[model samples]
Target: MPFKTYLINKTNNRKFRLDGVLRSRRLPAKHKLCQKFRQHMVLRTDQLPPKVDLRPDMTPIEDQSQIGSCTANCLAGAYEYLTKKSNGMNMDVSRLFIYYNARIKGNY
Candidate 1:
């Protein structure tokens, strides 16, 4: 018998984390157990209703510019703002600027 890690995805958007002795090819066993658990939960939901709540606002997502380097395009602008507000450092390095430099140098 070989040791294995079984990642069981359940219907209720939950997972079954089982790490112990299981029979060889016990996938059917795990799936049946998860189904039984879901059935039990559905029976309990009759007594309790779920609540719908909205999450709090953190900040707005910045627009993405097509300058090749999406990684720097996203963070470089945000980091400029953060550094300017917190540490009083004015650093403006955009993906468009980098792309322009790369083009001028005939490297890309």
Candidate 2:
């Protein structure tokens, strides 16, 4: 089946649409890295760099090609949240990165 992308910005409640198709099943099976990215991160949260808090600024992120790659956005947001938490400052994460990662995850 062909998949569509959709992105929603939590900060300003904006939405971004992208034109593309993702065949989750067709993703290269040999690229274990692709499948394991999230899992790997989950196991080593403490080791990973802390995320920044971006809520204070709450600047919305962009929707990447409308591909519904929210995971990347969430990751970016987390980074922003952590950053702010550590330094008492906020940051805007790149939504494009989130959208891209979501599509890579396929059905994530």
Residues 1-108, model 2: lDDT tens digits? 446676989999787877575545556757765664553335467776688654564535556566665667667877876777678776777778667556677774
For 38-65, candidate 1 gives per-residue lDDT tens digits of: 4334447657658733222112344565
Give lDDT per model, in order.
0.56, 0.66
Candidate 1: which pairs clash? none
Off by over 4 Å in 2: 1-65, 101-108
Question: For residue 31, what is the lDDT in candidate 2?
Answer: 75
Candidate 1 regions with alpha-carbon error over 4 angstroms: 1-61, 78-82, 85-93, 103-106
Give me the displacement of residue 8 in model 1, in angstroms: 60
lDDT of 2 at 25: 57
Task: State the TM-score for model 2.
Answer: 0.33
